[model samples]
Target chain A: MIPHDEGNGTSKPHAPRIGVVFGHPSRQYAPGEELVVRYDVEGVELPAIRAMERTVVWYTEGKGEEDLGVHRFERIDDLAGLAEALPHGTITACLPASPLSYEGVIVKIRWCVRIRLFFVAGRDFVSEHVFEIGAIAPARGVVERVQ
Target chain B: MRLPPFFGKKRGHRRTGSQAWGSFGEAVFYAALVAAGLCFAGLLLTGAVGIGPESAAPGWMRGWLWIFIWLIPGALLAFGVAGVARTVRDWGKSEERRAAAEGLGTLLESMGQSPAAQHPFPGVPACDDLVNSPGTILRYRLPIESPESWTLVGMGLFAGLWNAVLVVLAVSAGIDIASGRIEWVLLAVLVPFVLIGVTGIVIFIRRLVLTTAVGTTQLEICDHPLLPESSYDVLLAQSGSGMLRSLVLTLEIEEMASFRQGTDTRTERVIVWRDIVKEWTNLEITPGVRFETHVTVAIPAGAMHSFGSGHNAVRWRLVVRGQPERWPGFVRVFPVVVHPAPPAESAAVRHGATADGVPG
Candidate 1:
């Protein structure tokens, strides 16, 4: 797992540290292909983790209201289950065919895996890792020709 | 999934005391409206109000007054119900979040199922409705985005309603004149209304004539859910009795983006690319026959497939523009969908050839 920092400068010393590793090194996938993700948590105990959620979703960004679609989701609250998954976990899902990752002039679609940890004190921390879904080339802005 | 917050402290970060107090105050206000509505309804239904037949008013007028009075409770009840529903929905969302935080829901693993399978391409429009109608020569007929008949009907309705008001005003003025009492204000108003009514009629007539002369434009395609780098046959049919100066068919791709600006939401669309597919000049059509022709349309090899989301879209359309000999020019649009290209291996297999263009 590659460690990732939350980057919240004010976070306490005991705040959780999370890392995620994609199955593929390049983090790129084709349509109908399986995407594998593994994540690890550090500096946080299992008992203090009231709940945890893992999700894979695609969302739109840019000059429009954001739209999202969930591809996979799981929640765990059992302390024993949390302990088993605390240090490390693996998730696999088959990506959808459409809505391939697009980099357009005004709109873009992206895929990401989110890991959220809810502590006993009612505070939650989320970590996100982005990956590409398809090999479509980026779009170019059109130049208008006056006739 | 999340559970209701009926039993625990609210989830998420703690808020300031004042913010909590403000929310409590708002809830109380809505609750008070509901209580007031229920109390008023009970009083009205139980005949607690003093309205009766003994009131000093005619029976017909009293009936209207009772209806007007009942409106008070009706409006209150409507507002109260709407407010209650909104509150419940909001609370349910909060509870859902709490439940999620508590990990009380079942696992929702959409492993093999795609977003398209569950929601039919969440943001993209379903093409079944567009492809429902059959065509004469092509496999499917595309419906125009906007029909001109609706515009003609709107114009007619506006002209009819405006003239009706003008007639009522003219009769009122005539009655005043016959009584030897002239209301110059009413006469002056009549002058503008008469001019406006005449202008409305003239405009409506011109639109009607233009619509009848330009007729309908029908586009038919050989296949749908088009693939990139593929060519398909399209049929164009125009029906009307006139000399069309020029008819041009063009393929266009447009980008649409919507954003919220303060209190208002604005949507902007720009035609990013356009290519003229075919053009005809000096076409004559009889009333009984239509002008029909077939053309081949090819999607560029590296074109972007059609995409749609809640607030953004890349759309493809075929537009037909025609300028009649005497009437105004008209344009009709037909929307189409372009799906992503198939994998190279699948394409090669289907085409009975190797990837390098050698016979298999």
Candidate 2:
């Protein structure tokens, strides 16, 4: 469905609403279980990692494997704080970055979430729904904003 | 006129990945050029913002050197990328076709004719493959365009960067001499780069012409002959594609000696390959695009007495078909030899009729 409202009970007139979804949980992740961080970003469709639980160790790209950022999400405050810091159109659930808690479960996994943004159409005479990323299978977590 | 659909309504060219070497290497080459442009821009801006007047004389001399260093490499990168992308795109289209041919299988068989074929909205060419490739669903491909213009543009960008760097070097040197800035001393060493850029600009112009592929149909002697008897070396070399399989290949020979003894040379004949040239090939890549073809013919040489140089004589003839437009269904023929081959013996035995003693 085309979601028009952000997760925090807010909506913008011109902006497209963003949402994420996890797959039917496929295989196991690296050292820890997979963690998927989603954001129902409105009026814009972009994704980026705002913060991590620990200092950045390393990241790489390969087939059947993706190394996302390692972040500690101790409380909800850290998640919201980092989310607000990121540029609107850059960070999203589908992007390579995510927020994590220090005391809570470590969120370090690639997103299998397909974030689609729905915006009001202009002269095109059709509502615009764009997938922020291609097919992704999120292993865990709810849709939360980086801020 | 459209040829018969024997080869099927040929879709746009597809990549067979059959290209063992294509724009892929050139892609890397262009990407590296983009990087070089960025690096040169950075260096130019640095030299332009140099420290002041105290170091004018030394700084001025150094600035010229940096301009040369920065200009040539940067320009080469620009032209290489600009020109390479166009050629690569053409090649990729060929590969894409290859991918589609096998990818669609029987479903693609009745494209324009079958009722089950996936047809786009009102368009030309009757059929369209737009399910996977959203782009170019309805457009005629213009074959007359060339990407050489991009090379010239890239050269222009490189020139601007070089000039910018030169000015920066000049300004920074003047500033350092007047203000006696110590850090500005580092800026003076860039004079040589300026010189290289000037020289590079000229070299790049020559290189661009050498590399571009103009769609010209040129076939020349394989090698230049030092003597009248040049071993009859002939090879057909061209850099463009789009020749049809049924094309009438005409090879005109002009040399000291020529002879055909066996099927080796005659089979390969100076004729266009009717089966191999225009292929609807595809198999996860462009079909094998290259084939190493060669043929050797035994040329009968005269006693070397007819010609003044006691050398053999080979004449050249231009071959043309009567029906030029009705391509493919054609024939290949050579100029008549001055002396004809001996008449063949009749196979039919003279059982009834005789020449003189028997019944007529």
Query: Model 2: which docking level applies?
Result: incorrect
For residues A29-142, could you state the per-residue lDDT of candidate 1 as single tens digits? 887789999888888877787888778777777667666666676777888778877879987998777677877666778888878787776556667788987676665665
C-alpha DockQ for predicted model 1: 0.31
lDDT of each: 0.73, 0.31
Best by DockQ: 1
Interface RMSD of 1: 6.7
In the predicted model 1, the residue pairs found to clash are: B3-B99
Candidate 1 chain B weakest lDDT stretch, 10 residues: B351-360
lDDT of candidate 2 over B207-299, digit per residue (tens)? 454333222322222221111111222222223233333222342332222223454321111211111112122211112242212221111
Return the TM-score for chain B, candidate 1. 0.70
lDDT of 1 by residue, B1-360 (tens): 232233333222222122223445566777788788888878878888848767889888988888998888778778877876765555412222433433322225434557654433434555777789998888899989855767878989989999999999999999999999999999999999999899999989988887767788999988886666667789999999879999999988777778898999987677776778899999998898999999877776556678887688878889899998988899788999877655442333222111222110
